[model samples]
Target chain A: MNDAFILAGIRDVARKHVGWEGPIEPDMRLVEDLSLDSIKLLTLAIEVENRFQICLDPERDHELITVRDLVAAISHQISDTQKPEEENSHRDTEDTE
Target chain B: MNIASVGSALPPHFYDQETLLAALRANWTQRHHNVDRLEALHRNVLVGGRHLALPIEEYDNLKTWGDSNDAWTRVAQDVGETAILRALEKAGLGVDDVDALIFVTVTGVATPSIDARLMNRLHLPPRVKRMPIFGLGCVAGAAGIARAADYVRAYPDQVAVLLSVELCSLTLQRQDLSIPNLIASGLFGDGAAAAVVVGAERRADGPQVIDSRSIFYPDSEEVMGWDISESGFKIVLSAGVPEVVKHYLGRDVDAFLDDHGLSRSDIRSWVSHPGGPKVLTAMEEALELPDGALDVTWNSLRSVGNLSSTSVLMVLEDTMSDHRPEPGSLGLMLAMGPGFCSELVLLRW
Candidate 1:
């Protein structure tokens, strides 16, 4: 999914779980700005994983405090997977031409 | 009036320590953590087993607060009625003799509250005054006795009944994996305790309640509290609890005793709520109690775990049944709760 899609989903989940009413910006902190409890944060992480088919470890990834962190993590995973597919597509196009 | 009689009732379902530990381990693993610290914490608690209102299989099916509330209500009624009846029989008094009923519990909420339901179910006199206390947490037992004593002091011919039914096991949250929840699940048990306090003028064969006092610590609200969530009543038990108990218990005890023109040495027996191992140790250290001063309290904790509002009453019942004080002796009842508050009751045997 695109960055806007992921941010919107995170904002919606935060609103539902933590009663967050403020605007969702890329720099907003999950704990301080959103006031999400630990339990709600865990639930939010699970929801993000299920929606994007990517797993993010809360313990190892310590910088996942803002929407930018979530977008960067998802974008990294998507680009890493797209590399091999892009090469294969190039090869197929060369053979067809 | 003295605690003339006491009785306890527990649900039929029993979960041994090992079995509960194993289930907790499984649940904790699902939440992603090493269970070593939790296991050690459980071992230190000294609880061998606890009773649950429903079997383990049905625990997961409780999806809403209403469901758990309903289950707790049913068990509370059954256990409360049974304990009250047993206490009445032991006191050689009938339900009609009770002039006031004080019901205490934190595990569930009710529209009519448990006190009203008990009044209707047990056919208590319509004129009997009702006071249903919530949010006192574990301290309700000692507070209930203190409140009852206060009532009987004004009307020395009336008898008061204090009922505490805590189905702590019913509030188990399957999804939450916080350390507080884990510790609370293992430390608390399901039980009901009822004590009949007769006024001095109406006392036939029991001790006399002399005085009562309540003490509150300022700026300590977050030390212990409950977080009511969709899952269940998630406990927010901070580690500073033992420290809080150690800091204030001695002063509170001394003040309470002094108000009654007595001291700790004058009391021959102590009825204290068994909040947990650390809490007991803190109390023992703060008061400099003798080695066996809290034997009944420790035994109650080991046998029934912390029944929240019902724990101290069970200890009082045990003390009354096994070790009756001499005619001129004195007894002290003490308990602490979420408000970081303490209640003390002085009785003369």
Candidate 2:
């Protein structure tokens, strides 16, 4: 998946689910800039997990301060989970050939 | 009427936040989707430690709500007796001096209630009037004091003792995995408190009750409370608690103060309940409080978590003992609870 695609997904969740009217940016702090409270932050976490089909560690949420940090973490989780499936797909393709 | 003394008794079984968190994680790890979410929620409450009415291992044996209520009945009497004794002793009064006994709690129920049960144990006079309040939740601490003050105001020669025993830990629903229950588990604790309110005719070395006000928000029953079931009391906490604080607290407080020819600036001491981090933050923001105004409450929350109705009294005890303000300064004691309501009590030292 593209990083821009992940960023757009995050922006959509923030805007629609979290009710953030302000512009979502990579450097914008979720708490300080976007003004997402703890509940909203939790909602964002769950919605992001469902959207990406990847599990996010809520305990490590403190490490995700900015939108860029969140996007990067989600991207990392997606890539890691997709690796095995991608390898299996390649094996199946080669076997078919 | 004056607040003669405030005394508290915490249960013997104490555990740090990490230990409690570990125990909860172990219990919920199998069923919970993400254990990390539980840990994060617990850490966010910022409670350093809490006292439990029962031993940690003993909790698993509580198979039914009846079992929990039985434990609540046994422990409430002990703590309630001790708290009342301590408060009466501090006020240089005795059981015979207490003309009225008002008990407030929301954690559990007993047929005769804890206050009536304590009458025989504490040797309180048979003639003493008993008022057992149920379902007030956290606001009972401040509201209890206000009621005690009202009692003394009516009698003018009597002493009213208010006892609040909240065993919040016993009400924990192990089967529930909702966010509210998780937060409640992390936030609430177990304790009991008693306050001595003396009539104007009596002499006491403490703050005089100036006035009090109770404001209830209409159509907000779902804001915070307990949903009772055959199993037990499930927590009905809402994330919108902070929002409610932001919306109503400042205006209510300002109007309350204005009625007594005072303003927010006139209150030198703020003795508030330690609801939680978010509620305290919202309170500070709504009231536009000065730096360190609610430091005592914050410290209490960090140390003992929230003891439901007993918490504000613990804060009051701490304030009167360790953080006593100026001799003639004005103070305000406030708390919010399940009624989606706030109670404010003004005091003069």
Candidate 3:
């Protein structure tokens, strides 16, 4: 997934839960500014996980404090998911050759 | 007159957060679709681990409310005895020097109460006036100190002991998987703390109590408290908790400080209850504290989790041991609890 896709997914979740009618920028804090509570954050995580097919690990990425950080995490998870498949495909190609 | 000493104790059984989470998930059953929600809520409480009243495996045997309460009674006395004795030792006094004994807890109930039991276990003097306070919830720590201070203010030569034993784990409802229960299971731990406040005429070289205030918000009882039933204490943790702190904490604190001819900046040390992350953040926002003003509270949360009424006292113990401010510096010890109320105690070291 690209950054825009990740950002859009987060924004959609934020819109549903926070009900804030504003620009979805990169700098907004999920906690300090928007005051998204634990439940809202979880709801957003669930939405992101469904949309991107990525499981969010709250323990590992607890420091994802900002909108920018969250985008990076989603992108990282997507890339991490694709790597093993790519390696397996490359191995299959070598074997066939 | 002064908070002469502080002490804390925990049960031998302590578990890491992940282990407890796994156990809770197992108990709640994997068939529940909302289990992920439990994981999410539990992870965000900022707790690293907690000391439990019983072994993690043994909690499965607590099948009834009576069983849980029985566990509470049995464990409370052990930790309570340890805490009170440590406090007395730090205060350079024996059980006989204590003029009054004030006991506080919300996670357990007993007719004799833990104070009466401790008097017997510790062999305190017969004339030791006993006051057993229940249902104060988290605020009882600061409130207990305030009450003890009030006692010593009247009798200027006596020593008062305020002991708070909160076995939050013992009050956990195993079958209940409400969001509040899940969050509570994550946020609260089991422990006991004791404070020894001696009269001004009786003690020196300690933090003197300048004043204290108990602020009760009218008609907000449902904001945070317990709902007792046949199954035992069910948590009523409203989402409005942070909003409550935002709305009233600043004003109450300001008024209390103003009455004492001080402001937020004049305060040097903050002994605040680590009532999970949201409440602490709300307090920081409302008070507009400098960065790290609540570092001790956050550190306590990470280390031991919220021990209910015992939390603030444990924070006080941390303050006494690690973060002692300069002599004669002003300090504020505060907490909010089940009454949807706050107790603010001003101290000077």
Q: Each prediction's TM-score against the native?
A: 0.78, 0.86, 0.80
The local distance difference test score of model 3 is 0.87
Which segments of model 2 are wrong by more than 4 Å? A1-53, A57-78, A84-97
lDDT measured at residue A32 in model 1 versus the true structure, 0 to 100: 80
State the fnat of candidate 1 relative to the true structure: 0.00
Q: lDDT winner among the candidates?
A: 2
**Top of the candidates by DockQ:** 2
Q: Residues B150-262, candidate 1, lDDT per residue (tens digit)?
A: 88878888889999999998887868765567778889999999988877777556666777888888887877878878766888776666777788888888887887777
How far residue B349's Cα lies from its native spot in candidate 1, in Å, is 2.2
- In model 2, the clashing pairs are none
Provide the lDDT at B295 for model 1: 97
lDDT (Cα, tens digit) per residue for candidate 3, span B1-349? 8899998999999899999888888765533444675676788898999999999888889988889989999899999999998998988889989999999999989988889988889999999999999999999999999999999999999999999999999888877755577788999999999999988789655689999999998888877889987889998877777888999999999999999889999999899998889899999999999999999999999998999889999888888888899999999999998768999999998
- Decide which is better by TM-score, 1 or 2: 2
Clashes of each: 0, 0, 1
The worst-scoring run of ten residues by lDDT in candidate 3 chain B lies at B28-37
CA displacement after TM-score superposition, residue B347 of candidate 1 (Å):
1.7
Report the Cα lDDT for residue A91, model 2.
Answer: 100
Using TM-score as the measure, the top candidate is 2
Better of 1 and 3 by TM-score: 3
Better of 1 and 3 by DockQ: 3
TM-score, model 2, chain B versus true chain B: 0.99
Tell me chain A's TM-score in each of the predictions: 0.71, 0.91, 0.86
Residue B302 of model 3, lDDT score: 99
